[model samples]
Target: MKTNILSLTAIMVVSLQGFSSALETDAPETITSMGQIAEIAHATQEFFWQLVPPMDDPLYIHPDGIVRAVDWKKFKNKDFTSQMTAEMKTVSSSMYPVYRLTVIETRTGELLWHNSLDQLVWQTPAPLDYNPYFFAFEHWNVDSTEALDTQNLLWGRSSNVGAEILLLPEAFMESYEEDVALEAEAAALAAPMAMMLLSPPTVTNLMLAIGVESNEVEVGVYFPSGYTNPVDVFVCSSLMDWDWSLFTNVSSVGISEFTWIDETATNSSSHFWVAA
Candidate 1:
C-alpha cells in the first residue's frame, strides 16, 4: 500500500510540472533594442484594427456607441503601418515574461527613458494581473524642450521577495518619503497605489549598500540633497491606505507634464521584431 501511494504521488508531481511547462511562452533569440521593441509592438495586429478614423462618407456607430459618419472605403484594406510605434511591448521566454517600457518625445523623437524586464519575474509562470506603472518621464521642463527625468514603477511577482516591499537601505528609507512631493495642480495626479511594487535583487542590493532597510512595503524613495526636488525623487509602491492629500506638501513648479502608458498584455500571437 505504501509503495502504491508513493508511485501515485510521484506521477502527480511530474504531471503538474509538465502542465506548468506547457503554459510558458518561449522567449525570442533577441529583444534588446528600441527598434526591435517597437517591431514587437507593431506585430500585435489586433491593436491596429482601429486604423485611421473613417473618411466622412458612411455612417457607423463607434465602439463607444457614439453615432458617426464616415467613408468605410478609406479604412477598408488600409495596410497596417510597417513602421514601429512608440508603444510598449510584451514578450515571454520559457522561464519568464519580459516587458519593455519606452518613452519618447513626440516633437523631437528623442528617446527619453526606456527600461526592460527580462528576468524579474521570479515566480514560475509570471503573474497575469500585474498593474500598470505610472510613469512621469519628460516632466523636467515646463516646455519639455530640455533634459528629461524618468520615474517608472514596475509591478510583478517574485518568488524571492514579498510583493509591495520597498527594499531600500535603512538610511534612505528614513528620508525616502520626503523627496517625492505630489503636485496639487495636476488634477489627475492621483494614481493607483498598487503599482509601486519592486522586487529585483539589483534594486534592493543598491539600496542596502546605500544604507536603507532591505525588505518592507514602502511609500516612496527619497533622494539625497544634491538631486533636485520632484524630478529627483521616485515613488516605489505605496500602501493601500496611503493618504492622497499628502501630495500637496511639495510642488512640481509646473514641470509635471507627462503621460502613463500601460504595457501590452500577453497574447498567443508570435512576438518577434520586424525590421522597418
Candidate 2:
C-alpha cells in the first residue's frame, strides 16, 4: 500500500527516441548508485522509490510499466543481507507465489494483456520490524534487456507493500460509442438494481494513506500502535477496457511474444502466472 515504498497511479505516457534506451542517468539511487545489482540466471533487480519511464519523471521516461518499490530514501543504507533467517528466506521464496494477470475484456472478448510467465529470486524481504514503514533494499527487476522494448512491461515488489507492474497503457481504450439510444437503453434498466446493491458491510477500522509528490502517488499501509503481526492484506488492480495491444510475457519463456491464433473470436485468451 506504500508508494514503491505501494503506488500505481504513477503510470503515464512518454516519447521514446529509441525502443531500447532508458533515461537512467538519474534512476533513483536505490536503482543506480545506492542499490546493488545482482546477476541472476533469469532476473535482474531494480530498487527505487520511483522510476520515471513509468513515473512522470522529468529525468525523462514514462517507459511503459512502472509499478512500486520500497522508498529508497529510507532503505538506501539498509543492509538487506542481514535481515534474513532461513525460515523467512524459505517463506519469501518458495511459499510466496507471484501472480500475473490475464486481462481479457469481459464484454468485448478482447485480450488486453497478460504476462505468460514470471519468476522471482527473493533478494531481501522488507525490514518491517525496524524500518517500521516496510522499507527494504532492492526488490526484483527483470534482467532482460527486452524489458526496455515498447512491446514489454516490467513488474516489481513495493517496499513491503506488494507486487506492482509498470507499462505505458495501450489502445483498446477507445471504446466509447456515440449512440445515445444505446446509452439511454442501458441506463433505463439499471437504476432500480443499483439501489438495492448499496447496502453497507461491516469491518474493523483499517487505515490507508496516499501521497502524491512530483506526479508520483504512493499508497502505504498503517497499523494501529501496539499491534503486532498485523493480519495479511491483499489488493489487485488494473487498467481494464483499455490497451489490448500490450504484450506482457516478462520471463522470455516459451513464446517470446503473444500471437492470437483464433480468427473467429473478436479477442483472445492468454495464460499468465508468477513464481514467488
Best by TM-score: 2
How does each model score on TM-score? Answer: 0.16, 0.17
lDDT of 1 by residue, 76-179 (tens): 22321112122222212112111223222211122222223211211122225421111112112133312232211111101111111111212332232222
**lDDT per residue as tens, model 2, 1-276:** 111322223232121111211211112322221122221101211233233123221111112232112232343434431222221111112221112222211111211222323222133332233221111122224444343433122222221112222211112111111222344456548652211111111122223333323323333333434434333322222222222233222222332222222121212222111111
Please identify model 2 stretches exceeding 4 Å from their true place: 1-160, 163-169, 176-188, 193-276
Candidate 2's displacement at residue 182, Å, is: 7.0
| lDDT agreement of model 2 with the native | 0.24
Worst 10 residues of 2 by lDDT: 167-176
Worst 10 residues of 1 by lDDT: 4-13
